[model samples]
Target: MIVVQEQDFDLQHEYAALRQDCPSIGAIVTFVGLMRDFNDGDNVKSLFLEHYAGMTENVLADIVEKAKSRWNLQAVRIIHRVGNLLPSDQIVFVGVSSAHRGDAFSACEFIMDFLKTQAPFWKREQTEQGGRWVDARRSDEDSAQRWEK
Candidate 1:
């Protein structure tokens, strides 16, 4: 599943949905990304997010497909929210289910690594100084690169 929306999601609800009817799944792993109050030494008040609509979803779907191709995943879910958000708010979710913990853990991490570097989302953080456009971090790129063929 791939979702890009403005509404907050219920983590438990999503987890249940992933588990439903998938009796073969012996392990499930999930990750939720939260909006933080500080970034790069700046105290952030809020954030505004934007995306390229259809292109964003397409990219996310490609990421999910890649994870499935690499692992014996039973289920996968990814949700990313856009628009204005406050600190501590949920920003993204990634879940993976499989027959074993190793595949579940690795696939969940792989999906997130690609999501951070491949997704077409833009962010601007509100700070005391002013709103500033956030750029992709080199650290994120490094994390994503470890999975390259």
Candidate 2:
């Protein structure tokens, strides 16, 4: 499952929904990204995220499909929030369930890695100096590259 929305999500609700009625799933791994108070040496007041709607969903689905193909995952869920957000706000969530811990862990990490680079979401950070478009971090690219064949 993939969701791109402007509203905040309930982590507990999402986790419950992901594992609902799935007795075969032995392990579940989840990752939640939060907005920070500072970035790029500035005090960030808020963040505005924009996406290309359909394009963003397609890319996210592709990332999930890749994880599925690589692992024996029973389920996967990705939720990314857009629009104005404040510090400590949850920005994204990725969850995976599998028959084993290893599969669940690997798939969950893989999805987040790919999502960071492949998802078409642009971020603008509002700071004391004013708002500026955020740039892709080299660390993010490196993280994604490690999973490449």
Candidate 3:
């Protein structure tokens, strides 16, 4: 499942939906990203996220497909929120279900790594100084690269 919206999601609801009717699923792993209060030495008041609609969903679906090709996954769910958001608000969710903990854990991490580097979303942070467009971090690239090797 791939969801891109402006409203907040219920984590438990999503998890349940992923595991539903999958009696073979013995493990489920979920990752939720949240907006922070500070970033790059600035005290962030809020965050504004924008995406290219159809293009964003297509990329996310591709990321999920890659995860499925690499793991024995039973289900996968991804949800990313857009528009203005405040600190501590949920930003994204990645959930993976499988018959074993290892697959669930690895696939969950892999999906998030790809999502961070591959997704076409622009972010701007609001601070006391002004709103600034956030840059892609080298750490994020490194994290995604580890999966290639």
TM-score of 2: 0.98
Model 3, position 112, has a per-residue lDDT of: 89
Q: Give the residue spans of candidate 1 off by over 4 A.
A: none
Q: Candidate 2, overall lDDT?
A: 0.93
Instruction: Give TM per candidate.
Output: 0.98, 0.98, 0.98
Q: Give the Cα error of residue 89 in candidate 1, in Å.
A: 0.2
TM-score of 3: 0.98
TM-score between model 1 and native? 0.98
* lDDT, candidate 1, 1-149, per-residue tens: 89999999999999998897777999999999999999999899999999999999999999999999999999999999999999999999999989999999999999999999999999999999999999999999999999985
Rank the models by lDDT, top first: 1, 3, 2
Residue 106 in model 2: lDDT: 91
Tens-digit lDDT track of model 2 for 12-116: 998997797889999989999999999978899999999999999999999988898999998899999999999999999999989999999999988888889
Q: After superposition, how far is residue 7 of candidate 1 from its true place, in Å?
A: 0.4
